[model samples]
Target: MSFSSVSPSPTNHHQMTEDEMTSENSLLADRLHAMLHQEFTSYPACPDYTSQADHSSTCSPHSRRAVVNDDWRRKICEWAFGVVDHFEYSREAVSLTMNYLDRYASYAQSKGMPLSRKSFQLAAVASLYLAIKLEGRNEQGQRLTISTLVELSRGLFSVELIEQMEREILTALRWKINPPTAAQFIYHLIKLFPVEGIYDVDAKRVCNGILETSRFFSELSVYQSSLAIEQRPSIIAYSCILNAMELVGPVTLPCDVRQAFLTRIAGITQLREDMMEVYNTRTSLRELHSAITDAECGLPGGSSSDANQGTYDTSMLASTRVSPVCVSGRQ
Candidate 1:
């Protein structure tokens, strides 16, 4: 099938020919398909504790109690994001860190022995430290050292503790260190949108803004303990993108074009089969985005400025450390 073609935008100093566009789109479609398959295959089993409402509050193997409640987990997530931001690491590191953390928690809970708050904190630190090594680099392209991470823990944890916890986390996760992040899925799925018609200046800017806004939701999803634990990354990414479109597409896109884009995204993600799941997730994200907007602007009950109109400045969140790192047996 012949792919749709478009006039080159000024942003492209060199434009691809029709054949190049076709080949690139074909390659992207293949990668997207592969990712969709892989996302579901090795997905970590959600802890029984996460899904149940009444078993027991004790952190037992058969208990329905969560190893870490969402509020505490959210704080740790903020701290981890701060660590990555301070170290100039990619935000993807934060995503990987959380993946390790959630999966290990599930593993522990499944074994009838869940981690305590202090133990969970230690595990979180170790997971962040390990994820940095796997995903980050300094100005000199050097990975962060264990000693540095230990120091960042306010000397609460020793090098031995961090090292040992790293091994335990890796074992619990069965060394699946590279779980697909929602951000990875976002970039791939964005390519499925037809590039042919969005070359106009306003259209291009609005489209780019949609992707950026979607990325904001994807990052925020990392802070949501249940979203990633319950949903596949592909679904989360798709839902985020769709949410962004609902917020921005109507502003700049013609009705027909917006509908086409919506249709295209649904086809790419197979939204028909998972309509209810995606709808629920999108509703959650919409509420999340609304709450963030209100919180950012200090509004109580009314809508404030919309970050979806343009790119959101996440540097404030990156710099804010919510709480101290709790160490096991610390005063």
Candidate 2:
């Protein structure tokens, strides 16, 4: 299917009656709930195994080795985000790319093939390439080209290698790549808010800012292996939105109303204690939150003290060296 075919239409900003707004919100929420369930069911099995203590020991040795620690994964994700920014890809592209990487890696592990650092990086690049092709489009609505992707990689990878890796990833994943991401859920979640009527201009703006900020945190969570692998995407989306709302302060909805909304979301998403654990970890992790804040502020050329900065970061990430062949082969 064409990217434009599935792309979400912009929310109509025209004034509407409260009942109309509520009806629209209900329909969108139902669709989103169904999408969330589909994505949750489509997740690779490794996430479930990782969440279970007894099952951890049963995982193959190669699987264990392929699972990079959170620190390295964070650095890799930061570097990948830089590339995504350089190419002006949407956050959805990044989210989808990360999803591909995690699922493919898990599949490889299931087959007793651990990915090396270099292999993992290659997988990330390949996933991004696939995501851009699958989700990105130019102003004229043309799909991005392979040469452009090769150039973006700074010649670290050849087209053949990427093509080969893409094939391998697809084979490993059995070609399932359209899984819903946290960004999608966030978009739908914001729609659930009553950002209509005369006063909605500022309210909508605030909600958009909150959604963008939450997306940043959600993308950051992708690198934290535990949260990325263990928690459901819906949970991550919900947590990030809540965290962003906290940062933005109460704007459109009152405190009690917000709580009630959250309760409804939790019930709809069927969230469990693990969701709270993920949220608590994200909010309490000072370094991660600070890094995300800096990254978000730096996006719009804002200074460190600017809390109300713009979208995702555009700054180049600090270089972290890795050997081309430091680790062994994937198989």
Candidate 3:
């Protein structure tokens, strides 16, 4: 007899028992509460300067309008995402890096310090470096050295400049480096699915698909300047899930199960389908995902091929409007 014939079938593998569901819910509740509490504390404040004074006008040359803005931040976000992907590092680290950069930018602007164009790029590199060290490990399980970061900058910044920028970011962020990113929230929120007593393997597979797609949406959200300005991780996370669910539609994911899962999410996050914020976030993510898809199809080599090759072509990336950042090697 074959081994399969002798062994018993594990039919209950996809089923989540009541006790397990309760335990998962309790743990997720506590974690989500802590994330919401810190969300307000570490969230970036809105820029105070709306209108830019003319360069020849009475305002100082280093006005907030003349310095860093959402465009610059968006470029850094794109570059950082490519770097993290090139190194096989966790993309969540990119989100965390943006958290550092955005909060630091707000603090600097509030304090009357000019985040010069050069300083912004330097700060972005340092932010990514710090985030990677905190949460990423190479294939060999080693942290990348400062020298690697300098090389990634193409020697535009030396070790000393990178170190100083890192220190400045830390000080400005009050050393509270850990922000509850949308990607983190996505995983936690997915745990609240009403999976109790469900034994269908197909159902489990669909749920997992939704989760992976939701994470992709979260990654895409990192590149949107408006989403960064919105600064609500929990809502953003909820919106990603909702958009993913819509993209999957009722055909693949049964309507009853989908409704139950969404109900559980709304109960925990207080995010109603009718709320304007949720509607806007979902709309933005859907549009962004569509735009990215169109852009990728136009590229010479698709993102999947580039990822498999373990390198990003700076030339091709520049064609996508991403800033020139050296990410030419594996970790």
- Candidate 1 worst ten-residue window by lDDT: 297-306
Regions of model 1 farther than 4 Å from truth: 1-16, 48-55, 58-67, 139-142, 249-251, 272-274, 296-331
lDDT of each: 0.69, 0.62, 0.70
lDDT of 3: 0.70
Ranking by lDDT: 3, 1, 2
Stretches of model 3 off by over 4 angstroms after superposition = 1-17, 42-66, 196-201, 297-324, 327-331
Across residues 1-331, which tens digit of lDDT does each residue of candidate 3 receive? 6465454346554354655767877888888888887787655434422112122223564554456555556667877877766666776888888878777766786787757767778888889889988986865577778898888877788999999999989988779988888988889888877654345435566666667767777877887767864548887888888876765544455668778887887777676778888899998987887787777732232243332332233332223433335632223
Tens-digit lDDT track of model 1 for 1-331: 8875886686563445666877887787777777777777876437533433233444565443344666657777867776666666787888888888888887887787777667778898899888888775755587878887777777878999888999999887778787778898888877666545654436656666667767878887887666867778887888888777766433354557666766776665576425887888888877876777667732122222443343334342344423434333233
Q: Mind sharing the TM-score for model 2?
A: 0.70
Clashes of 1: 1
Better of 2 and 3 by lDDT: 3
What's the CA error at residue 270 for candidate 3, in Å?
Answer: 1.2
Q: List clash counts for every candidate, in order.
A: 1, 0, 0
Which pairs of residues collide in model 1?
61-112
Whole-model lDDT, model 1: 0.69
Clashes of 2: 0
Could you tell which candidate, 1 or 3, scores higher by lDDT?
3
For model 2, what is the alpha-carbon lDDT of residue 7?
43
